[model samples]
Target: MQITDFSVDQNLKELTEHRTVVLPVACYVTTISENINGYIPLHWHDELQFIHVVKGTANFQINEEPVAIREGEGLFINSGCLHMAKDENSTGCVYICLNVSPNFVVSHELFTTFVSPYIQATNLQYLHLVPKDAWASNILESIRTIEQYIHQSQPFYEIEVSIELTSIWKNLVKNGIQLEFKERETLKNQRMKRMLNWIHQHYAEKILLEDIALAGQLSRSECCRYFKRYLNKSPLNYVTDYRIQKSQILLQQPQYSVTDVAYQVGFNSTSYFIEKFRKAMNMTPFEYKKYRN
Candidate 1:
């Protein structure tokens, strides 16, 4: 019943279209949470990121990191890596999340459709995530530089962050790899496309206010406000409707029971699940299953 309104597809499409010169994230925002059990769910992006956990404990992993990050830490994941954040069910956390694109550094490196291996005769197109030094002062300074860069759209903003990021790379990414992001000149788009992509990723999980806040990283409330402004419903309802569509394929499977299938598609309560299904499909899961057969 947490349905509101937002168009996830439209939002991203707009972002993709803005091929800016100094490509930093819209802004630098921090999320501080006390619940150690809070999970960001699994996700990935084309942009490289720097995360500084200011306080408490956090269990974070970049692809192939081989171990979860312990408390009192930070991480710098390379571009286009599968990453997620969670708590150890022990302590709260305050972390800073920063994102930068390859174009933000090297604009000449246009994102190519074909992968290039062996740049210097070795099989390599991108780099891997790795570890760096943990000098508290350097981390603090680097974080500040990024914040400053975001505020002033001045000349050489990209250059400033690039230098600091290099320092951050040497200081934070633990046993990591480095790969540059691919850039394309003709990829500008409308906002709807981005929204579609965002919604596509987390539709199966238990999406929440923060979940859809990711629609554009607009604060959870703003995400709802903007979503209501455009798409006319909330992000939760957006996911539920999408889940119902995806469930149609599963409902036909004889292996599923209505209740079991509802949860599988992301409904926690069978009753609420049934209500949504009926609201969207004009029938409960039972009827849907019967019809499918």
Candidate 2:
């Protein structure tokens, strides 16, 4: 399939706009050096994802944990996990990513029996697949085969891809049945999602720490703890970063002046916006706009 970038909605749900037409699977190769930011931004989706590093090492954050996968290594991200990745070194990192929908991979009865438990397992956010482990190696090989099959697009290639995917899923279940189910992690994830959604929705308006905490039903301190635990940033810091992120998009358009873009993204002071933008991006908003053009 063709390579494509993805966007998320206010609630951080991936829009799934680039899946292949014939199947509920999307396969693409990503070269981190080619991206303006050299990383994929944090996002989540309901589809299961498999990623294989093909070149330099890739560093990833899955939920609250960090993982690094080197060349020839792979990772399995469970459904509903918040994740992001970046090139570990300045050198380019190339990887193949496949996102598969459970419904498309199995019948309803089979999905209930095989997929539901894993998807709902809060303690099992991700699995790092290495070549040394037998089961993980098998899954990795199956991923490679699926990537080949999709790239070739031979007759009945879809069926071949389906078989490989099933094999990977089987390996995952056979090896992952022992993971403990943690309801607390589930609740934590839910609260974090609520707070993040609130931030995204109100990012263009005046937002306060108490306002964000209220959206997640959290006190000010608990809200700070949760943000630090999951996102490694304070609530106000996250809001500033998000505002800067939004400003990047607006800066790409020629019609908006720097001050206009700054205010549009919730920064009340144009000078303050310029300072933060420079700190985060290492360039002024005007310079970034010029660079983009």
Provide backbone clash counts, one per model: 43, 0
TM-score, cand. 1 vs. native: 0.43
Encode model 2's per-residue lDDT on 21-46: one tens digit a residue. 58888888888756555478778998
Position 224, candidate 1: lDDT: 69
Candidate 2 Cα errors over 4 Å, as ranges: 1-4
Highest lDDT model number = 2
lDDT of 1 by residue, 1-293 (tens): 10011122312221232123435553344443322113443345556566666666566644323234433355655544444466656466566667665445333452231112112111122232222443544765687677677566678786776677656544433323353333321121112234546677766676776755665646777666654544456867767767876677678899988877888888888898889888876678788788769
- Please identify model 1 stretches exceeding 4 Å from their true place: 1-22, 32-37, 64-66, 70-72, 106-140, 148-159, 166-293
lDDT of each: 0.53, 0.86
Worst 10 residues of 1 by lDDT: 1-10
Score residue 145 of candidate 2 by CA lDDT.
88
Q: After superposition, how far is residue 229 of candidate 1 from its true place, in Å?
A: 40
Report the C-alpha displacement of residue 98, candidate 2, in angstroms. Answer: 0.6
